[model samples]
Target: EEEHTSCEIPRDAIDVCGVQDPDDVSLDNVKEVLDSIKVLFEEDKTIKAYRLWKKLEGLVGQYEEAPQEQELSDKLMNAKELITESMFMLNQVTMEAESVFALLEELDSEEGWELAKDEAGIRTWFKQPEGSPTYHIKIQGTIKSPIFDVLALVNEVDLYQKWIPTCDLSKAVLNISKFKRMIQLCMTPPSPVNWVVSRRELMLYGYGVDMMEDNKMIAMAKSPSPGE
Candidate 1:
């Protein structure tokens, strides 16, 4: 059987369709490319969109500040706005992806860790496959404050009693080095013991994470020093 195929035009073609003039310097191609990029971003192809945004940023720069060419100027401005919007969205997605990947990688590494305690934004874990006399505690969480603020709060020995509920007294005993300290903490338990005094060796280690540095503070106390 012989079949005939025919193209049908929509009823709204009169309102939506137009012929492109050869002399008109329009940004139709740029608009189409930007629209496709928007679709890619919507589909969670952020890396691709980001790459395109960087390329479009350069292309759009060429037509910028051309007052004599009003049409070209308008097209460039439109492209610039679109590029900016795409860049902002792509950056946000990139940040979210990084955060999620970091958390996932951490979880993957901690294959056998059991959640011991969860409070607010902090999570604590008890070490599995134990082999040492000292119990190891693994704490993992994200703080909304800047990393510097966290490091400062941890290293300030004088502020411990003010913030810690069990601490009766806190003092900086000695500054061994920039990354180490000897701190004294006195605690009064609910029992008959009047006071308990102890000294802790606080060691600080910092490592870079993206644009910021993450600090790890380790406090070790084997035997309590005599309090006079």
Candidate 2:
């Protein structure tokens, strides 16, 4: 005879496994989880794994099958596995999003950047951050057009090749919301460099918001975390 071990649910989570009225005890737990996930999602819209897991949890909770002790235990174990995977994925995405902001913060500081070019009303700086082989470049220039006009032009992805230097293609990969989207940009190096470098492609997640009170608009973008 083979011996089998049973999976046990924590006393607090027993209601979630259908041992008691889920609405009574589990509602608080569900709300807590949702609130935490909501905060994370708002901070980084790329965290979709938890939302997907929550939907699955709702479907499982609504199953018509009688909740036997063993069956409930099995369901709880499966849910635990799903929650673990979802949390791991969410954490990975959150870390990547934080790194993007961290780099931006570093760039905001004036200490490390060295002026590389200053001509034709355009200024450019370059920085070789510690531990990075590649150099980070920053270009600053004033556009003569109105902010709204510039924003409109940027939002028109098809017009990128016409005005953006070395741009070969630009298109939206996903329209996440009215103001947020994931885009793909392909840049070809100029002349002889193109033969040696080939075409480079970037996957960027970007958003634009109008600050009505400040009478200004802001647009930001960064490469999305993997699997996002």
Candidate 3:
């Protein structure tokens, strides 16, 4: 049989979010982040994303500062990146992620990283600036599948690992009102390319299935930091 064809999605369809002050986030704060980022490629406001990204990093770093198992710290900073979006949202995430990082790389190269690999070193370099998502991958295909069936499958919540790209595990947590769930997955593709890992942690990760009661998956998406 031929490989399955997956759906396509637009890049702006995602919500780039953080849950640190989830309770405090108002529509205004979200609008500010969105507006500031548009000028990120311009020299002036680039620092805004840097500052925010560093604050986010500091939150993670503080955990590292606490006495913890070496294994734990490694896992924290060296988190394998997760591609939280489904095939429907993959391409959209990719273009958005690329735009975010390209701007950051330009700034970081000014003082920080050389943006080049060290030929002599065993470790390869991944160039992500202070405030940037490391990277994101895009996968596209078409399925003869229908949307209502997909919704029924989503109600099951046990079938994602078989088809969803980024998810390693999934389970339903909220049923009717919100339709929420928990998911975990390895960041690397089904086949690992090369090592030297990096990640943009999505403070919150979720999957949603769209349907019209006929039992097919018309659309699905995820919210997480896109990857490199």
- Model number with the top lDDT: 2
lDDT of 1: 0.51
Off by over 4 Å in 1: 1-112, 118-120, 128-134, 191-228
User: What is the TM-score of each predicted model, taking all chains together?
Assistant: 0.34, 0.54, 0.26
Clash count, one per candidate: 0, 0, 20
19, model 2: CA deviation in Å? Answer: 35
Top TM-score model: 2
CA lDDT, candidate 3, residue 141: 39
- Against the reference, the lDDT scores of all candidates come to 0.51, 0.60, 0.39
By lDDT, the better pick of 2 and 3 is 2
lDDT of 3: 0.39
Root-mean-square deviation of Cα positions for candidate 1 versus the true structure, in angstroms: 21.6
Q: In candidate 3, residue 227 scores what lDDT? A: 45
